[model samples]
Target: MSHPPAPPTSPHPRRWLTSRARVGLVLAVPLLGLVNQFLGFFVLVLAIVLIWKDNPWEKAAKVVATIAATALLGAVVPDPQGKDAGGTVARADGKGTAHGRAVDAVTSASPSPSPTVKPGPRAADYRGLRLDRAREKAEAAGFGVGDHNASDDGKSIWMRSNWTVCFQKTGWTWSDTKTIDFGAVQTGAPCPEEDGGAVPWPKMPDLVWKTWKTARKEVVDLGVPADHVLADTAYVNDTLPDEGDYDDWRVCVTDPSADSDVTLDAWVTLGLTDPRNGCPKSDREDGDRPSLPDRDDDGDPDYHDPFPGDRNRDSAFPNGLPRGSDGSGGSSGDDDWDWNCPHTRWC
Candidate 1:
């Protein structure tokens, strides 16, 4: 009829987009968009139009083409730091590649607020704790501890757990190299009012009327050695007493005399007596007397008694002589016992 209907011609461009070429372009559009969004944009549009007109592609191909066209419209720039990643990339997809990278750079360049630093603790925080405990806490807090007696007693620290911290010198916070110099005392003792070199020896206190146990505590607390203090009855009742028995008896006299200065190691004697028997009139009872005739029957004997014949009269002499007597065993004074006693001592 019509001259064999002339040779059928291809609907697509003969040189590049023939039937085989169109199929290849449709499949390649997604890859092209991934490489360069600008290039992908045109190819994606062309692929969609070819698919719709010639009906050469399946429904899946058409779907792919639409998605590629919308997605490749702009470029995407991912944030390297992750701080602005979601917002930056999402914004870039809507804008173009040049605009996307510009926004990404600004987002990454913004300076983060400088991080603040925290300081460490001070040594004074550990004051009043046991030396061992304080040292542990201080070391954990990045500090070192050095300790000595706050009473200034010249004693070496052999046991840290037995001592308590009184004061500290290091004041800085969180110092790795700082050593906290601590003034310390024994666990049971109170801290000194002020730092001292050596605890001053307390004077001998009058223990009269105080129990043996009470007397021991007073001197012992004042830095006296417990063994140096002793208790005895001087045969007042010929009754030997034990520690528990001491609680029953009361102290009547002290050896060094009350108010005398004594050291920590000084030996002290307590004269015990039954409260019912009452203390003897003897000025002393620790066997220091001469043991001569006690004419007045007072504790003093004639050998060195101030006045052997008359207890009421002051001996006329000081060098062991009685009132105008010859070879009297009295030592009250020897005509002139020595000026040290008559003028300067008890009248």
Candidate 2:
């Protein structure tokens, strides 16, 4: 019976733990002293001496001397900026090459700044170009042919090299004394009323009795220039005819005369004639032949003498009626005669 009492002598050789191993050694020693800080502070002082065995060893040695004086006062202080264990930051001349420049000056990482651009203004596109190359590309882009505005759908604005642009003003951000406009058209002239439908100009017709190769093909179909249609010979009598035959000549005098209006390609002249001298009369003809002199005693000549100075009134000679100077049917100064045929037909 005294042997069974021997089992009660147990002061602490490690065996009586269970209350769930004293709450699993008081939560596994501060989670194993946050993983390995010296093997979790030597397994947190051996699990606080087996979870304070039966307590009082002077309150379990003052709870393991207050967790070893708070892990020896956080390992004797010192981290001003000397961080280590790979959190880098060491140098105050404690060279590891100033610990990579003190971890490139405190665990490194700064680079941000960048942004600045500017440059606009300078234009000259000139649409279909050619008003003298759109004024040489708007005066070589520095603008100023008094800036610009050309505009000329015909009526010859100095025929700007026979024109072309068609309409311009384009995008324009311009500024070297800005100004633009452009419009143009004539090279074969037309498009202008805001570029839609214009082509009219040609008119100048009646090239007189025609033929200097039909008046130079009607003045080169009005765009003018069968050498600006000049011609000039016109001699009904002199006889100088060795070889001049432009279809035997004919356009008798036309310096803008026949139905006049003018201007398209301008410069006319003509005067040809010599159709063996037949049609050249025009000082506005039609008096029916009376180069003057027949005061009308009725020979029917003062331009067919209607009552030319009335020789007893032949009234244009009705079937043989000329009896003047008192031959009986009535004559002698026929009641004081004074007719003067067709307004004194060049009397």
Candidate 3:
């Protein structure tokens, strides 16, 4: 046995490992370079170490190097939109100068200017001018006439040329829509009539004995303006009643007698009384005897008696028909001495 130690077994495993390491290094360096330059450099150094130091830990070191290279390559590659690894846009010129980079940044950051707007039509003042002139001025200023109205109550003068503008809707200012209205009156006509030239003068309507509601409607039907008709209500107890709750009240008297003529703007006042106040005292009722106040013994009341305080004419006639009697509506006459006389003693 001592004559010759068995020839040392050839190191087949070590030789196999060295050959494998050389082949791995050759393949890894070029493959990694295709992925990333920096990753390829790092992998090259790692491959050299793997080849020179063939030890028990070599397998693990090779594995770790391969994984690290793969990860680094993935991080270094550009994105699909040509952005760098850090997500910044890459310049196509590839110039590294500071001025070039600043110019690129400014161009991207600047916003485009907005489009200019054209101006619109302007407004103008048209107060206190004649209607025709006002219309002309308005049209000249790019406006249109909207409405025409009377400034006061009167007949609406259909002729615009004969109208005087007292008020304008837009006043002195111009409007965007370029339209205006004129409250006008007929030329040479009253500028501010009581009825604003809206209604014509009408005969006073017969509202007596009509309810307040009916009276108001008659007034309106007669073309009398609502403001021209005034209402005065008296309750049964002589207390003022609410004007709003006068539907049940009766019309007692009117300011102007029925069938009287009145101006268009005249105030036709209605005197209303509660139904509980009984019939209104009027000469038309009961032959004017009950309504009249005759302090003396005359047959006629003071209003009709010619000789109101004279006993000689106390019961001679009705309403002092014989005009020659004194203030008392009485005179001696066989025909006048009727059984239906107000003064029975004289009859």
Candidate 4:
């Protein structure tokens, strides 16, 4: 008599493959000269085989097999490192993590080549557009420009972005230099219609003031030491009738100590609605000359400082000036304005 239908058995012949069989299947992929895609397929098959047994031990084994397969896939994939649209993560510290490191490598390697930043309008293109002229443009816009430095080799220029109109030096051997940016004039603004092609700051309140405050803080917090910084204002402008009513600040920095020709950091502000009250020009020291006369007679200078909060005691002149003495209802250079009032010219 024929055996009773041979006892119902598993449909898959290899459903209970031994551990060695599973390992061999995975290792055999590379040896068989199969491409990574094929190996990936095998990995899935192996996992299925191991798990089909319905044993806890088998399930654990399948998971391990899958992990091994994924590791190999990383090697074959063109860019296994996952990256964001910007090609990098927003945070720099993330690079220390495994995933972050991978993402950074992939992004840096392909790097869209930095979009070949096109050269902007040259300072010379504007003809009489020297640093002072640019400074004037910033002031007229209601912004300010702080001291800046040039590259040691003169190939690149960088400055604090605290002011609007600023310059930067760029290039390696052939050394090309160019004016990089104008201060924040307004938020979401296109190039000013009057300036022909100068980028305009957006007039939006949210973006203009908020961004300005952020940039100013960055300058104060990150600026290189003066002993390490060769500072100068290549351009300063207080009047730009064509541009909308906004202040712009610009600056440059050169790190000679590091033997680098490129400006390291720059700061600037744009679209200042109100003039920053400076240490009131001291009349106590110069009451004799009408030219020295405080225009507002508030004991403060008529011109507003691009950066208003003073930290140096020296800038505060004619000691004993009271706080809120400024005609604008703020302290003039007198109150806390001691010989140490950091804003004082002689301090």
Clashes of each: 8, 2, 21, 81
Quick one: RMSD of model 2? 24.4
Name the top lDDT candidate: 1
Worst 10 residues of 1 by lDDT: 97-106
lDDT of model 4 at residue 217? 44
Give per-residue CA lDDT, model 4, range 108-209, as digits (tens): 355455667665432322212344456665445433333232212222224322223223322222343332333222211232333323443222122222
lDDT of 3 at 141: 75
Clashes by residue pair, model 2: 186-189, 253-271
Each candidate's TM vs. the true structure? 0.37, 0.23, 0.27, 0.20
**Please, what are the lDDT tens digits per residue for candidate 2 over residues 1-347?**
45544455665545434435654655554555555456556655665665566544467665665576346534543343424534344455644354433243343444445564333334556656568878777777765542222333334457566667766553334333554556676565544455444545556677667677777777777667666767765542222234445565777667777665455557887766556454545665664422224575444434335666766555434433434433344436545322432222334
RMSD of 3: 19.3
C-alpha positional error of residue 110 in candidate 3 after TM-score superposition, expressed in Å: 97
Cα misplacement distance, residue 218 of candidate 1 (Å): 6.7
Kindly give the stretch of ten consecutive residues in candidate 3 with the minimal lDDT sum.
98-107
The count of backbone overlaps in candidate 2 is 2
Residue lDDT tens for model 3, 279-338: 456655444312335656554445445567755454445343333433344444544544
lDDT of each: 0.63, 0.54, 0.59, 0.37
RMSD of each: 21.1, 24.4, 19.3, 26.3
Measured with C-alpha atoms, the lDDT of residue 84 in candidate 2 is: 53
181 in model 1: Cα distance from truth in Å? 1.6
Deviation of model 3 at 154, angstroms: 14
TM-score-best of 1 and 3: 1
